[model samples]
Structures are given as structure tokens and as C-alpha cells.
Target: MNAWKMPVAWMSMVALLVGGCNKDEQNVAPTDDNEAITTATLTLVNKAVPTDTVRATIENLNTTADFSKATLNLKANTTYTGTIGLLDKTKTPVVDATEEIREKVNEHLFVYTYSATSGSQNALIVTITDKDTNPAPGPYPVGLSTDMQTGAAGTGTLNVVLRHQPNVKDGTPNPGSSDLDTSFPVVIQ
Candidate 1:
């Protein structure tokens, strides 16, 4: 039994060494011009919840808050506002979602309205910041690539990072405590 176990362990070690050498390489470079620069300006947008599911205690209004369509044009350097307008099954603003909302937006269409600064500052910036301040109060959209974060800093390609907001005491359903502290990933074009 002892001799057999030694052979088995030695074989396992050799397999592990061989498998480790097969690991994939990182940061592969393009081999050909087939990857020409895409001339047509494109926008890549995405949004996700920090938790797997939302709590039942949340207000319908809060549940409807989506960052799905929020987008920023990398080429145009512009932000467009988005919404998740509700209509009965007929598709109309149930309340007044038709009107532009302040921080209380529903659509996930585009990015936020930003102040254009003309200094030595990095121009091609995208921003995604949060504040309790807005023209009105509710759930204002945040900037993701605004400021210098936009493709302007250097490579227009910026991978987004999501950190949740902390509102834990209000009582929502999540394994992790809910708060503005809990956020998810979103990106711009």
C-alpha cells in the first residue's frame, strides 16, 4: 500500500507541473492589420445590480431605477440621458416619466450633462460620480467617464468599476447589508 501511494503521489505531482505550464498567456497583441481602427464611433453600455436580487421593502420607484442604457459617446464626447419610462402594458409614462427627471430619472439611455472645461485638463474625459446635490432631488444619474476618466486621459477605452451606495438601514433584501456602499459595474462607449 505504501509503495503504491508513493507512485500515485509522484504521478499527481508530474501532472500538476505539466498542467501549470499550459496556463494561458496574458495581454496578447494583434498579429495583423486585420484589426483596423474602427472608424464608426461606437458606444458600449452596461449596468448591473450589486446584489443578486433586490429587497421587497424597496419602493417601486427605487426598484425601477436602472443604469442599463446610460451611455457616453467616445467619439462625439457627449452624454445623453436615459430612462425606463413606464406605461401600463401600453408603454406610456405611468406618472409623468415623460417629462425629464432631475436626479429622479428612470430611463437608462445615456450619460449626464457635464460642464465642459477648457484648460490643460484632460479634455476627452468621461465622469461617473455621485452626490446628494442635483437641480431636484431623487436618484440623480452619475457620470462614469466624465472629468479625465473618459477616453481623453489616454486610451479612450476605460473599463468601469462599480462600488455600491450605502443605504443599509432602510431594509432591502440582500445577503450583504444594503447601502449607498453597495454598487455594481457600468460602462460607456
Candidate 2:
């Protein structure tokens, strides 16, 4: 067989052999098929008291929105932990998140980690409501408290960083927890 022709034939055979292989994989998206959007859910334990008064006292401030804009988009349904923070005018994180995960509209929170396969991402939507009967003032997150530079209220981008737990591959120990800052932004609503 001619050398070039033999290699060409081998390449053609491999293509024909592998072309028909259909490997079903993760397809993240907004779809009706149910497998469209990929997601990772984690429930962190809360170390802060649920009482607004206690929280305010600890912070040395009134729970009242006062002149300060009230934080929002804190979904009450899900419990979260760690310092949920907000950056200041100079783009510095001023208020460190003390609650597990706050529930209200217009608040920025932390995500432990989300399961997003590479190339797939999820839109993060946060819902903060009036934890008490007395809801705080308006112009909250998207318009009220924080501005575009601070954070996108209600919705943001959650790109999958890596697989969950152990951070290992093929039975090897995975690296570190530096992926905590993994996140993207959403437009103000």
C-alpha cells in the first residue's frame, strides 16, 4: 500500500468508526427536557441568631433601614452561613456578611459552590423580603441599597468551577478551597 494512502485510509476508518458514537453528557440550559440547567445545592449551617434585634445589637446598629439602604434579595426559604458581604462606594467590602444567608430583596450573599459543568452556567436569582412585618425602605438593591458596581441584585451569573467534594480526580487528592470567589455578575433588575 502507498504510505500516504495507507495513513489516509486509517484516518478515514477512525472517523467513520467514531463519528457514530453518541456520548450523552450534561447539557445545561433553560429547557423543558428537565436536564437542561445544571445546578448544585448546598445547605450551610447558620451561626447567627435569627432575631433582628440580636443581629442589630451585635452589629451595634438598629435593624432599621434608617438612612442606610436596606439590604434585599435575601431568600428566607433557604438558610445560608458565613459573612455575606457588601462593597462600599470605593468598591471595598464594607459590611461583612455575618448571617448564614439572609432572606430579603436586594441583598448580596455568598454561594458555597454550584455544580456547573464546564461551558454551562446558571443565572443566580436572589430574593430578599421583609423578614419582619415592617419591611425596610425602597430604592434597595437594583435601585435601593447597592448600585451596579456593588452587585447585581436578585440575579447573577454562577459558572461551574469544578466538581463537588474531595476535589480529586482519578483517585488523586484535589487541591485547595480557593475557588470560593468563583462567581460572575448579573444586571440590576
lDDT (Cα, tens digit) per residue for candidate 2, span 130-187: 2222234423221111101112224434322321122121211143222123343222
lDDT of each: 0.30, 0.27
Per-residue lDDT value at 149 in model 2:
18
Candidate 2 error regions (>4 Å)? 1-4, 22-53, 56-175, 178-189
Clashes of each: 41, 28
Writing each residue's lDDT as its tens digit, candidate 1 over 1-189 gives: 699899999999999999888776576886431111111112233223222211111123234534343333332343322222221222332333223222322222223223333222343444434333334343444332223333332222222222223332111122222112112222223
**Alpha-carbon shift of residue 164 in model 2 (angstroms):** 11
Strongest candidate by lDDT: 1
| Structural RMSD, model 1 | 19.6
* TM-scores of the models, in the order given: 0.20, 0.20
State model 1's lDDT. 0.30
